[model samples]
Target: MVNTRTTDYWSQFIVDYSGGGDFFIANAYGKSAAQLSYDRVLFGSALQVVENIKLINNIIVVDLPVSAFQGLSLSPDDRAFYQVIADNQHLTGYEDLSSAFRPKKRIRRVDGPYEAEYFDGVYSAEKVRFIKLSRKLIEGELQVGVVVYLAQTLQSRNEMAHDISVKALQLVSVIFTIALSVCYVFIWFIVRPIRRLNTVLSERAPTDLTPIDTDAPKEISELLRTINHFMMQLQNTLDRLKHFTSETAHQVRTPLAGILAQSQNALMENDKPKRHSQITQVIDSCESLSRTVDQLLNQALLAHRFKSKALEKVWLGALIKEVSRDQVLTALQQKVELAYIGPNDDCQIVGDTVALKKMLQNIIENAIKYSPKQGVVEITLIIEKNREINDIRPRYGHS
Candidate 1:
């Protein structure tokens, strides 16, 4: 489209120049027939072209010898106009002239307006464009071809286009900068609090399970709350561990000291019976100490499992039977009869199996221990419908 428009202006200019030649003939209307005939050929067949604010002072015929247009060719000192036609033969036809001129040769679309030089003429090249125009004419009985070239320099249009482009680029750059700044501000607000939390956490000692204090957004505040909850749990666990360690040391020390004393007593005794009794006491003390250690270990394991939320379905009848069997020998030694009674159907309940078994065992054993000689330690599983017991106490009765 740009090429077409460029060629159009040049073509219009050529037509205008030809009209000027016709006016010249009109002024010499009263001349002789031979002169009028010559003027008609000159005005009708002559190619009128303009370039760089100057008229085309030279002309040439393509197929004919250079001498044919001798007077017309010698009119211009600058042969550049003729040189353009000789280089592009397609510019000879009126129809092909618009399409033949390539933008690369004569037209340049620049980023900004600047000065342009053409045909020894310097003009503001801002929006200036060049085009080639051509047409066919009749000279007597022969068909002659005429070509014209022209330049259209537009300073106002170039300045407008350049100004619009600059403003558009500036607007895009401003928006991009604002978007980047907002993202940076958002990231800083989010990351700053997290970094503070990390610092507080990293500076704590291994044993320091204290809750943390954080001044942060709601989301970060929730995260801190979870951390504090876990820290409280850890503190509780640590306290339990300390208490268990001290109790174990105290409980273990007594039986161990008694065992040592029994050993020394056994060594001093000369009589076989006396020595045997001392050895028996030492064995009993050792067994009791072992039982205490086992109970303490099992308690620790139960606490750990509960902390992990480990639970399972347990049958009350089966659990009671198992505990009674384990305590049967102990009950026999204490001269007590251990018995278990349960419903025909198994009573199922959800709880930690290890903890439940230990609880039943401790209760039955205590009952047997406190019972009189020849007393019965009868265990019963009583199922109460729609009742949840908040507290329970074990009682023993001698029969």
Candidate 2:
């Protein structure tokens, strides 16, 4: 394709200069005269092309002898192009025109031309492809060559592709920025409720066992429910502890006060018998106080153990009889008859031993305290299918 274009351009150049080459051929005599004609016509044509064509730029016609370089009307642009060729003498792929004029290098009638590239001044050191044409002088052995060049800059060619690439990069950057913004918004929305919940909990007093309220995200609703459940359990535990503390203080204070009063009475009594009786009552009060403290401590320990204790098969009758022994002292003091009568065989049930003992101890102690003096307090263990305990305590005022 480049060969065809070069051939066509060479033909057009020959046509443009119709009579110029013939004029030189007619007046020529010796080799020097032919070289003179060569210099005159080639330089003339270059000047003509520069003047006539407004678009043509960056051209250099060389090998026309240094002597012939003088006496030519040159412009600033033309001088600059000539200087560029002179400076970079070894510019690839542009060779000196003198090489084509070598004496041994014969030019065949039907030989194809080749192309080369050189830096054009208008394009600032950028190589532009040019068509080189050489013709041997018929009258002499000297050869003349002309390099027809087209100057091209980096800024030219495929402007649309460059623009499209730039726009595509900008669009991708914008999309990436938008994606990051969306992720940040989503993360903040999800974490806002949890952060607020933490702040509320941290700011609250240690005694405050209130359940938390929040409009949490649906993804963490189950977590919120679990937290609320824990809070409710905590509140129940706190309430139980408060009730137990108050009851223990009240129960313990009564026995301690009885001991104090009995001791004072024993110290003041003049009769030895009365004083001895008062001393005995003080001793009894101390024993009752010690039992109450031990029971309260055991109840607290039992409450703590309820969560982790394993269930064991326990005989209900034996458990009842053992617990009844503790209350015998209270029953005797109250003048109430405490009797346990149940099945002699193994009445097995699955339960925690400590929990059941505490339960029975509480029931029998209440029964003996409430029963009338010398009244029968019968304790019976009934193993039923549905697993229920029916308490049949005697009426307070009954015979």
By TM-score, who's the top model here? 1
Scanning candidate 1 in windows of ten residues, the lowest lDDT window is 111-120
TM-score of 1: 0.53
Instruction: Report the lDDT of model 1 for residue 358.
Output: 80
All candidates' TM-scores?
A: 0.53, 0.42
Compared with the true structure, all predictions reach lDDT values of 0.59, 0.56
- lDDT tens digits by residue: candidate 1, 35-72: 32332222222223312112232334344234323433
Model 1 spans > 4 angstroms off: 1-178, 328-336, 372-374, 388-399
lDDT for model 2: 0.56
- Name model 2 segments beyond 4 Å from true: 1-185, 302-348, 359-399
Report the lDDT tens digits of candidate 2 across residue range 1-399.
369767556544543343444423322322334333333333443343322322113433333333323323232122212311222243232243323223333322222333222322223444321212322222244332333332222222222233333344345447768999999999998888889888988998988877777677788889988988988888888888899999999999999889889988889999999999999999888888898898899878898777557889887778888888888888889888888766465466788988888888888888888787878788766556675444423233334
The weakest ten consecutive residues by lDDT in model 2 span: 75-84
